[model samples]
Target: MSTDSPTDGAGAAASVQRLFRNTVVAVSGALSRRDGRVSLSVSGLAYFLLYLAGLRHLGFGPSGYEVSVVSNPLVRAFRQVGPFQWEPIALVVVGPVELLVAPLNMLLGAVLAALVGLNLAVSIVAWRGPSACRLGPGAGAMSGLPGLLSGFACCGPTILLVVGIQASAGLLSLFQWLLPLTVVALLGTLLWVGSRVETAQQVA
Candidate 1:
């Protein structure tokens, strides 16, 4: 017959408790590392709100436009396909350059939001430590600069519009595409960073 020692049982219980405590600490630390990303995203959102408010206060709003869809012979011939009705495409009527201000501002705001989301995701991976994933320190923070610059595009154009300066069609087109490009770039950066982290984690 065998009897368990009281001291051995107590030591086993203490070991389990210690392991639980360490796990909790590690989880909390990992979560806390995301604080910076959260703060930046909130700040970016606030800036968007302020910008929209300013635009409304300054008498800027959506311009009137109409779009129609019709089957075109040229399009059909180019595709070597039978007559087909094209999809309804809404085209903003090109009016006074100032009229483009509101749309441009909206685009920039969207870009900023996208950037913030990507930055937060990247930051989380980065904070997980090199063992979890390998992103150089601060990579997530630096990724936000393009989004910030895109936001500035809206401010600068709005200022020019308010000052009665007209922007050329070419310039307006550039602004039109800038937001989408910025969003894509931010997404690409996020993917790149995430892949690096994933790869490192796998290797480790």
Candidate 2:
């Protein structure tokens, strides 16, 4: 058994509370302006579409309109075939585009997209604001890394075709963690950016 005491637990809880409060402050502050709102909407939508494209759920095909749903979609939606990936239970085709409707995957992608958007918006707003609040290019890079890494993960074996790299067990194993790592990085960077924003507010 672990030896952590009540005081340690309380301290950790307080720390988490502070972090969340600061993050909320940062987010609310960013979204209060037109630029931040635009950033969130555009970036979020773009990232979500890119994420679906990475999953190969949205793509071009013969021109037609059709919607197909699998039997027992509710049950199938929970089925997992890869790390952070779920089975698609429907097919939607309209014109030259097609989409595999996977409820779980869509949910996950939405979450990742939202995080990426918020990260970019907060970082961009902070960087463009007063001198004390400038977060710089590092924030942009951090915000982008998750989308790229997770996109590669979503591509699965197909990514090898794009990168021209031979597949191996080691490489495949690494892919399993990419989405999770991306999530962690997104959250961590969000908190870090918020902390900077909070500090800047304090300084000013």
Candidate 3:
């Protein structure tokens, strides 16, 4: 009574494997597209360079000279936040630039953390459906914009304060909150986009 060919089962398995492979390729290709990759790389590299500069300024690099507390607007803002603990690690005079290593490190860390969140969001969206795979990279990049804006604004306020402009404590607090909000927004955007794409695919 049962006359199903063995090859039928093997063929079905092979077909599924092909589909999975193709989906992976499509998602990776979309993320690695020229524009998307450039945007991500530029942001990542900029953050890394800034972090390196901060390290150098703190006398922890090849061009380092001394350990001194560099007072700046950003440093003041960080002090208000109380998230970073700044301490004098002995002095060995080298230059005359005000460099707040703790705050700079925090800024770089936020960028890296944001980037990781965005990547996860993209991966989720890309794996959801074919349409989502097409939309994931661009949407992920757009979502990351808020984080970048927050990072820039964090430093911007301090710069203005350094220039003798009155920067409000409330404004600095708002920037501090923006980083977490950006991560939440990115996750939401990816979920929403993925749902819409899945729905559209179903309807089609």
Candidate 4:
């Protein structure tokens, strides 16, 4: 009976130690996640608000008058840039309510939200076990890509707003509208890809 008593006491002590260790780990993880969640929300909301404001200023129309094929002989010479030649193509002036910018803006917003969520996850894992996060500098950079992508999405509309407003005054007549078109196209493509990443996460 004496020996059995010692064995039972030792087992209870071991179990208590394990329970304490687990409790500490869980609390640490939760705190880290909470910190990351706040960061993500601040950054994401800033981008969403900025984009909405910029879109409001980019009143509808081809931005500047659409360049026609006849008006832009350079397009024929530059076949690759032909799609950008706004002139001659039938124009559809969109109303404020008909703005098509929402799709891409919302897409980027979604990616930003995911980025915040992933950051929180990583933080929690790191808190639970430092080795579990396994993210080096490269991984950190990769993780930040979604936020950068969101920046680009917002910048696209900003560029349009600037060029469209500038050209309206004939100040940038010499500067081709191709600049805005190409920038918009590139950023739009990136936002689309980022949206796909965000969508996949929802499915998972």
Question: Residue-wise lDDT of candidate 4 within 1-204, one digit each (tens)?
Answer: 345688899999986665444434332443356554554566556545544444451244434333223344444333332222222212223442223223434454455444433333433344344322333223333434543554454355445654455444242332344335434543443333222232223335
Which candidate should be chosen as best, given lDDT against the real structure?
2
Tens digits of per-residue lDDT for model 1 on 103-157? 4445556566545544443345345453333334554345345434444544554
Global lDDT of each model? 0.45, 0.70, 0.46, 0.41
Of candidates 4 and 2, the better by TM-score = 2
Ranking by lDDT: 2, 3, 1, 4
For residue 165, what is the lDDT in candidate 1? 67
Please give me the total number of clashing residue pairs in predicted model 3: 0
Note each model's CA RMSD in angstroms: 16.0, 4.7, 11.8, 18.0
Best by TM-score: 2
The segments of candidate 4 whose C-alpha lies over 4 angstroms from its true place after superposition are 1-32, 57-132, 141-156, 159-204
Q: List the residue pairs that clash in candidate 4.
A: 66-86, 66-87, 67-86, 67-87, 68-87, 68-88
Q: Which residue ranges in model 1 land beyond 4 Å of their true spot? A: 1-34, 50-112, 120-166, 198-203
Q: In candidate 3, which residue ranges exceed 4 Å CA deviation?
A: 1-29, 47-100, 103-108, 111-113, 116-132, 136-165, 196-204
lDDT of 4: 0.41
* lDDT computed for candidate 3: 0.46
Q: Comparing 2 and 3 by lDDT, which wins?
A: 2
